[model samples]
Target chain A: MGWISDFLLLNDPTLRVVVPGVLLLCGMSAAVGCFTFLRKKSLIGDAVSHSVLPGICIAFILNGEKNIFYFLLGAMISGLASVLIIDYLTKSRFARNDTAIALMLSVFFGLGIVLLTYIQHQGNASQAGLDSFLFGKAASLNKDDLMIFGISSLLIFLLIAFLLRGFSLVSFDDSFAMSIGFPVVWLKSLLSVLTVWSIATGIQAVGVVLMAALLIAPALAARMWTNSIIKMLLLAGIFGMLSGYSGAFVSYALPQMPTGPWIVVMASVIAFGSLLLAPRKGLFSQIIERNNNEKKILQENILKIFYHIDEKSGETQKAVLQEDLLNQRSFSNRNMRKGLRILERKNYLSNHLGAWSLTSSGRVEAKRIVRLHRLWELYLQEYLHLDPDHVHDDAEAMEHVITPEIEAQLDVLLGNPTIDPHQTQIPSKDE
Target chain B: MNSNDLWIVFTAIAVALICALPGCFLVLRRMAMVGDAISHAVLPGIVIAYLLSGSRNTMYILPGAAAAGMLVTVLIEWLQKRLRVQSDASIGLVYTLLFAIGVILVTAFTAQTDLDQECVLYGEIAYVPFDMMSIVDGGFSAPRQLWIASGLLTVLIIVITLGYRGLYLSTFDPGYATAIGISVVFWHYILMSMVSLAAVVSFESVGAVLVVALLTGPPAIASLFAKRLPLMLLLACVFGVLACVFGYLIASFLNASISGSIAVVIGVLYAFSLVIKKIFF
Candidate 1:
């Protein structure tokens, strides 16, 4: 609690500088990252981050001072150069996109390292803090750095906010944007510039090695929760800001911990959590949905089996033994018993000793399933010119899926028929 | 040249050769970034292994780093296949997460040790000549990194020579390979494992970034000249060795990081090849 108050109150001078710097950096990077993610160019962010090292080193070597503005300019230039080279290499027949990306990333970073070691050997006093750009020194940021970051982040944010429509259009379908008379090329170049700008600015907070995570993780996590670009941008920003805050706090509490890795770890945790747990598209939820659908199909299949048995014997409510149900289909014994128990619990079936019979409501529901199956089979036979034997398997699959509206349409399309293509009496809806 | 210079060049050539061998297959399969990913992700495996074994022996660290590399490939596959994440995003996500964890582990526990974060990115290749291992009692000795690298290279060359057909078939036409009863999945994993091994072996001298440079740069440059697989592999190795020699020379002249100079030289060579292709071909 004491630490929490200290963190929240920003009692420490270092915390005051680091906390806002990280939040602004991460939030803007994430907001820009969504477009890159949508364009399926997320790895380009990684390449740009790595490529900025040489730019920073060159800026230092030339300026002979630790000017933040010159570093950003140099980083942005090299970052853009790397991106353009990757694009050209990918377009060429020789190298693939992945190869081009890896080539540019390692080579540029290597050059940066070369210059960096050279600078170290020269013993330049100002070159002491340049290596911090490699791994980030968030706590070392001063008021002037914060002012620069705040202004740049605000400009990028407002720019994105104003051109949201064109940006989304270019990301989703550039050709369509072009056809609609939008300046596709200009918009694309602007987007690339924005991407490089964000990476160059954010690199100092998270370092060259882990900067891509700040761009990608929040956007990816936000993507899992949304389909709209606006919502994704907002969610990604919030997620980024949250990770930034927590990462700064943790590094503050434990002075030994590095801030950049902690920030990446927090963002990754959020992204992985979203991937595994978000609704509908999430892995766990999809698995659960699939399991429930299978169970429903199994239960309906059991009901259809009972209805078929009743139809043959001309006894609407006759009880059937478990063996009778098992003999009709190839269902395993465990699944059959499980389905029967579940059906009975739902009052769809009444278990009498060792036998089971459909209840009144269950018979009605069972009748509808059978009717849909027969209707689909007849429709496939009459309209598709298929043999009666070929229609049953297809209808068997569709029977559990057809909604009531589709059932009526099929009934009307089939001319309210009472006889199926196999010359069996179709179950009437009212009955 | 002095013995130190000779020994450094030898180590660099060995590392470049080892990385370029598996790197050809990675490039052919268009999975070069996976090599990049594994190179970074092996860090945590290294730290955890060091913690458990409490030794810097290759016996402990190699397997740990190799295992970590395999985990990265498997996780990327799972994310792509099962979770339906796009391939690039998944690669970016998994490697960065693992790398972040590695950085954390290094800072938290290994701060007192020799394995610092900077060393992980930019390895101490120039210092390789100093860490000698005596093969005989008061007789012959060699740098420890050279012995480890040479042993790994021998193993790698033998594996590639023995498994050439399977590797060839799997990379070129996986469906046809499967039709002929060759297990595509098995060969894919085998190649990935070899890549992991190469990355781990090279991690000491060149560090992760330069390992990627060696892995991708040589093969990419070679593909412009060679069409056949064997020729491509030979050319890749040749270019890799050349890069090593030139990089070492440049590093000595500039008094800079050896691995970094090698990477820059590889880039220069790649550009040179591109220019050659434009003029001659």
Candidate 2:
């Protein structure tokens, strides 16, 4: 309880400075990240982050001091240069975008490394802790840094809010947006500027090496949960803030740990968790749905087999031996017994002496299944002009999925046909 | 140059050639970032292997790091295929996640050890010549990195020689190769394994960050200048050797970090080539 209060109370001044700054930075980056992810330009964020390193080094060299404003300005300038270089490479047909990104990323980072080493050799006391830009030093963030982040974060939020429609339009359909007179190019540049701003602001916390993760992971996680862009932005912002808070807490607890990598680690867990467990599109849910579908198909096939047995005997009800079913279809014996037991529990089958007979209630279900099968067969032969033999296979597959409503529509559409193309009598309703 | 300087330059050249060889295939496949992924992803493997085996033996660390490298490839593939994450996004996601885990593990267990994160990021290649391993019971000795890099270089040469045809077929036109009954999937894993091996070996000398630059930069420059495969391979090696020679010279004169200078030198060479090609062609 004491530890919880200590963590959550925000009594420490460092926490007050670090927490809001990281949260705002993460939320803004994640929001802008949605557009980049949709644009399939995720790695471009990576290139831009690395490109900013030389910018910071060059700024420190030029100013002979570590000023936050100069750093941000230098970062934005180099960030824009990286984007322009990538654009030139691909647009001029010199290299593919990925190659261009990789090229720019490594080259700029190398230059930054060289410049950084030079600064270290000069033995300037002001250059102390400057290398933290490689892997950030979030704990050193002060009230002034927080103020900068606060203003920039607010500006990014309002910009994204105001331009949501334009961003989405351009992201989803660039040519369509252009055709609709939405100033697609201007919208694109605006979004790029927003991305560059967030990245420049973020480098002080997350650093250049892992900045792309902050820009991408939250949105990647949020996209797994919802299809709507608005929900995606909201959820991503929430995830980013949660990760930011937790990362700061953990880093504060353990003195050796860096907050930037920890934050990314937390975001990844949420993203992977969402991918594996989110409803509708997640891996686990999809597996469950597929298994249920297979089970349903098995149950329907068992019912159809029982109807065929009664039809062959031309009797109202007949008890068929278990061996007879095994010879009719090649399903597993274990599955056959289980299906029989399930049917019996439903009051759809009666079993005595290892022979199964369809009860009255079961007869009605079996009759409907056969009716759907034969109706589909007739519809295919008459309406689609498919061969009578081909219609049987098509109808066999379609019968299980045809709902009661669809069955009624098919009956009306087929003019209440009494016999199928094979001259088999279609079971009437309530018969 | 003195003998120590010669060994350092040799170590750099060996690391360069080993990385640039497979890097050509990566660049051709448009998977230049995969090299970046493997470099960072190998961190956890190195740490865990050291913790488990209680030795910094290459035999133990190499397999552990190589396995970690394979995990990066497999995880990226799984996310893209099963979760429907975009390919580039999956690459970005998996490597960072693995890398962050590696960073945490290092800070947690090996904080006191010499395997600090700073050394891992930009390795001290100038220190390579100081760690000499005796080859013949103190009769003949070489730098440890020289032995590992050259041995790996020899193995790489053998693998490429034996499997050259299949590697070329799969990398260029996997669909065509698959249609013609070549095992494209099999070749892909083979290439990935080789990439993992090269990345781990290079990790010792160049460190992780510059390994990406070394693996990708030279070959990227090579692709711009060469039309034929053999020519590209030759040009990549030449460019790598040149970067090492010039980078070491510049670093020695300035008393700066050799690896950092080498990376800058490669970028300079790339830009230099770009200009030359522009002017001539």
Number of the predicted model whose TM-score against the real structure is largest: 1
Q: Which residue runs of candidate 2 sit more than 4 Å off their true CA positions?
A: A378-386, A391-393, A403-414, A421-423, A428-431, B111-113
- Candidate 1: RMSD over Cα atoms? 1.2
Best by lDDT: 1
Best-matching candidate per DockQ: 1
Off by over 4 Å in 1: B111-113, B136-139
- Candidate 2, A181-264: lDDT as tens digits: 999999999888888888998877778888899878998989989999999999999998898889998898887889999998
Every candidate's chain B TM-score: 0.98, 0.97
Could you tell me the TM-score of candidate 1? 0.99
Write one digit per residue (lDDT tens) for candidate 2, span B163-229. 8888889988888989899998898898888889988888868777788888888888898889987
